[model samples]
Target: MLTKKKVIISIAVLVVLMTGVMLLGNQEGAAEAENKQVTIEAVNNKVYVMVQQVNFIEKAAEIEFKASLEASEEGIVSSKVGGKVVQILFEEGEYIHQGEPLVKLEEKEAGNNLRAAESQLSAAQASLTSAEVNLESEQGNFERLKVLFDHNGIAKVELEKAEIAVKVAKANVEALKANVLTAQVNVESLTDSLAYTTISAPISGMMDEKSVSLGQNVDSGTILGKVKNISPINAVIEVKQTNLEDIKVGQKAKVTIGEREPLVYEGTLKSINGSADPSSRVFKGKIQLDNPDQALKPGSFAKAEIVNDQKVEIATVPLAALAGNEDSCYVYVNDQGIARKRSVIIGETEENVVVIKSGVQKGESVICTNVTTLQDGDVIEVVAE
Candidate 1:
């Protein structure tokens, strides 16, 4: 009953209607799939969490300075008088005490001179004794002549002669006594010179070196050896000029010795240099260490860590939680079950622990382990074990 052209057009219209239905059905299916989608967990917050906040925390600070371990007291020993080295009592590296003889010079001439002076002193004493006896006898004679003259038994001229003899004998005795004193002084001088032949230590320490051998001539004030007292050693460290404010006298410092493990020493800051090195811009600070066991030696390399102050109970977080520029730190904190971005003020980072001045609350969960995939204000479900 229908024409052929009308039948063909009707077939084309039916085909287009079926295609539209198929396309609509496919789009509806895609919408259903999207509504049923689940969130992909991109952050594992439990893996990198801090176990506990350490109180009384010390900031990580280092002073990489040119340092030296030296005896608190050190000196070079020298001879006070010039002499030939006849004998050395101690060898190099020997321990010596104050006033301990270290060397002996040949004192043949000194000994002879001392003996001659003693002999002169003895002779002068004998002369003094003889003059004293003559003077006593002359005085007695003068007294007798005076008494006789009063009775007119002796002439006045005889009394005058007796008096003159007494005066002369008294003068001779006084002169001889003075000569004895001079001789005694000379003997003492010679004795002291002989003693100078034996050079002794001026301090108690280890003698590290010897400059002269037996029979070697030396001059006064010449370096004979070195005496270093290693007890209570000294350490010198260079601190940055910026840290000069923190460094002060009487602050405690810890030092490690000689690259060895478990060998540590505690020291007190002794002095700080007023001026810094112009080229390096670093100042020098000295510490006094107690080395009672004498384990630390002079010139030994040491590392010093000085603690200027202690950290307080401020907001702190793991170093991994920090984001953005190093100076401008941020963290992802949970706000009402949603991930929120917070800008925090920070200070004094050490050993993965960063101090927060503001913008983070205590006991609030912060994105610790994986924070890169989080967006601000995105709903999140806290995963708990």
Candidate 2:
């Protein structure tokens, strides 16, 4: 009976020892697995990313204004003389230079009148010359008669007749001289009028409008056509009365059509109105754009993005790096190997760039790639941009 009790006690003690050893082994295995998982997570958190340093940028705001484009210089071409449009020399949209002939008016009649005036001038001049010649001969004859009469070689009647002839010749010559001067003035007037029959371009430009055609009769001061310069186009815009102070001559602007990406242009503010518009209560402004190739057409709809002279220094980051909802916009910045979250206030977004209005410092590196996969404290690998 004592042997049986001893064996039972030993068996119970052995069972207790085996259970304790198994429990200790299980605890050690669980601890090792936890440590392995932690190591794996540390390795997986290190993700490759591209980063860019934050830079202080000059802040610019776009002030949109609707405008119409026009030629830098435009004018109406008109005829100076009343005549028939016998010949149309230029077509609409034709490029021309200053003093270039654009239209011809009744050249036949004008030429005839000019020639007639020239003939009259020649006849009057010839008459004047013949009278002068006769006067000289009569003066010589009168002098001879006076000398003969004084020497008692001729009668007083002969000397008096010669003197009368000379006086009549002198009077004829004076009348012819007056006629010559009158003819000369008439000739000049006709010549000037004849030249005016041919209309000429007043400025170097392209013909935008044509009102006269062949066989068309047009009176003086009649509209013939319109011409406009090609280079350096102008965009005339209207600004609100309250925003007039933000616009001024010499300010730079970006010009564009509505959603026409390929047609973007650079323009400069050229003029501002001296007074606000009374009816619309808006102010007039002008921006000039360079069109060296004459690609942009006048009278087109355009807009000007005028930037004010006022600028503020702000930090910038890549647009791709921004994350989170509108209520909580943030960026990931690399501090050593860990990503630090920064809440930001955004300003203007220009293409792939965004202005960080606040919550960013210059010279700080910002994680630009793998932004969505990054957490507030995740590790990052900065790669070349």
Candidate 3:
């Protein structure tokens, strides 16, 4: 009975030793696997990214906006007197100069009235000459009578009658002169009416419209056509209230027209409205461009870029570096091989680059690629261009 109890106790001891050895081996295996996993993670954790150094550059700020082209000078051709359109001297799209006759009207009636006025003036002038000769004779007789009275050779009553006769002759001459002046005025008035029979251009420009045809009788103040001076045209633009302060007259601007292949024109800021438009609530701006060829037509759509004279030093980065929308923009900057996401305030965008107003310093490396996949604190390997 003693031997059987000892054998059972030895068997229990061997089984406990084997279980301890197995537990030790499993623990060693788990430690080795954990160390290998840590080494793999340390080697493959870094991401490859492209970075650009932020640069400070001096550049003039530009404002871009939509614009509409218009002629600098526009004239409305109209008639001052009613008449029949005898001859049309200019056609639509014809170039004309100031004071150039554009339409001719029948001049028979106006010519006749002018001739009558001239005849009346001639008759009145001849009558005045005869009256002046008569007054001279009367004056000579008065002088002779005065001498006779002084020498007591004539009666006082006779001398008085001679003086009164001279005075009456002078009065008659003055009345005739008044008549001559009235006739001269009439002649001048009639001459102006005769000249009005021809309609002339008020300004130098191209005729853009025609309202009267030959043989068409038009009343006074009738619109004949429209003339527009297209050289040195105006490009009108609406400026927002926020950007009003940055622009002023005399600034340089570039105007572009067409979409497929744009035509660029150099211009200057001509005017800015003092008050905002009632409907758009924006200020109207005008840019003047020299169009010697008249290639810029009126009412054409255009785009304008106004460059400010004041230059500013600003930090810039590639547009690809921006990670968020316009309202919320961010960029990843490499800080000693570690990517740190930073929120940035952006300004104007020029081509593929953007102006960084804040949150990034000059000469700092900004991650341009793999921005979306980068976290707040990411291990990064900057690659060459």
Q: Would you estimate the TM-scores of all the predictions?
A: 0.60, 0.61, 0.66
Best by lDDT: 3
Residue pairs in candidate 2 whose N, alpha carbon or C atoms collide under 3 angstroms: none
Tens-digit per-residue lDDT, 295-323, candidate 1: 77788887887766644455677777778
Best by TM-score: 3
lDDT of 2 by residue, 1-385 (tens): 9999999999999999999999999999999999999999888868888998998866666688888988888877898888888778788888788888888888787789889999999999999999999999999999988999999999999999999999999999999999999999989988988999878888888898788778888888998888899688888899887787777789899888654243678889999888888888777888999888777788888877898877767788889889987677899988997899999987556899988878888778888988887888988888765
lDDT of 3 at 59: 80
Task: Give the lDDT of residue 81 in candidate 2.
Answer: 82
Per-candidate alpha-carbon RMSD to the true structure: 8.7, 9.5, 8.7
TM-score: the better of candidates 1 and 3: 3
